[model samples]
Target: MPEDLTRTARAEGQPLSETDNVEDMYLTFALGGEDYGVGIGGVTEIVGMQRIMGVPDVPAWIKGVINLRGKVIPLVDVRLRFGMAERAYDDRTVIIVLEVAAAPVGLIVDGVSEVLDIPPAQIDRPGQFGRSRSPVMGLARVGDRVTILLDAEVLVADGDLALPAELEA
Candidate 1:
């Protein structure tokens, strides 16, 4: 959690701890032309795009891994994971690091927007429209902007993609 994010959350009267109302807080980011969000709880930190060392025998979406601090974290290209066309990484590109299933994984995104306090009343669950499973947890509407809320666990643990054996706990 960044200082600014904490300040913003506090200013908005949103709780930031496990025993509080953390469920309503989401870290939003830009993906392609739309906005997407993930629960802030699992997010460890956000970092600028770093060099991704290539690895063998992994899905294309698994862009590779990056060494952060003393730990190597596997990077997942969110666009490719969602079956979207690849785009060149730019200055705005970032990696949202998360802890899923007790393992560290990084999600490469277009750019991050902001931390929003979206209450349950503002979110609409994604019912069984067709797909058997979806990464989307719900659709959150903040004023006129709608953000697709994604399940971080599902995003990283999708059927077609699996982290390298060493990356798993």
Candidate 2:
């Protein structure tokens, strides 16, 4: 450690304040009553959930595949993936376009919320959400709500999550 820097911080008592360098936006959405966020850098676009072709061999969490602008992207029910009780779809339902683990997939969320700019400083440290297991990174503030910032790496199940045929490049 540099002697000059260490002396300055010691005088200040508190550790150096970290800067919040938010590079991009997040597509905030909901599952059941909890708010969640997906980094928008990988997002292609958001679309309304439509007729999905069901595949039987897969797990129930894999709701089906949606025909998104002629491309067959698989849809996952976020509520079911988290083992939460799900309700019937309504007008608020939306399919969040996500480019996760190199795949351009669509996640079926209860509803689309808004595009949020969550600064790194405001984000809370990793913690448990009751006994519910989460594959997300941690939580961050969005107005009065604390949205779980999902790790795109585990946003979708590995078995079915593959890069969109067009996005493979």
lDDT (Cα atoms) of all candidates against the true structure: 0.83, 0.68
Q: Over 4 Å off in model 1, which ranges?
A: 3-20, 159-169
Best by TM-score: 1
Show the colliding residue pairs in model 1: none
Candidate 2 ranges beyond 4 A from true positions: 1-24, 127-134, 162-169
Every model's Cα RMSD, please?
3.4, 10.4
Per-residue CA lDDT of model 1 for 20-137, tens digit only, reads: 4667889999998999999999899999998898878778998988889978888999999999999999999999999988878899999988887777888999985577777899
* Residue-wise C-alpha lDDT for candidate 2, range 1-169, written one tens digit per residue: 1222221111224332334223435667888788888776777777776988776677788887876766778888888888888779888898877777666678888887765556676677686555344567767865566888887666575456553455432
Lowest lDDT sum, 10 consecutive residues, model 2, at: 1-10
lDDT of 1: 0.83
- The TM-score values for the models, in the order shown, are 0.84, 0.74
lDDT of 2 at 129: 54
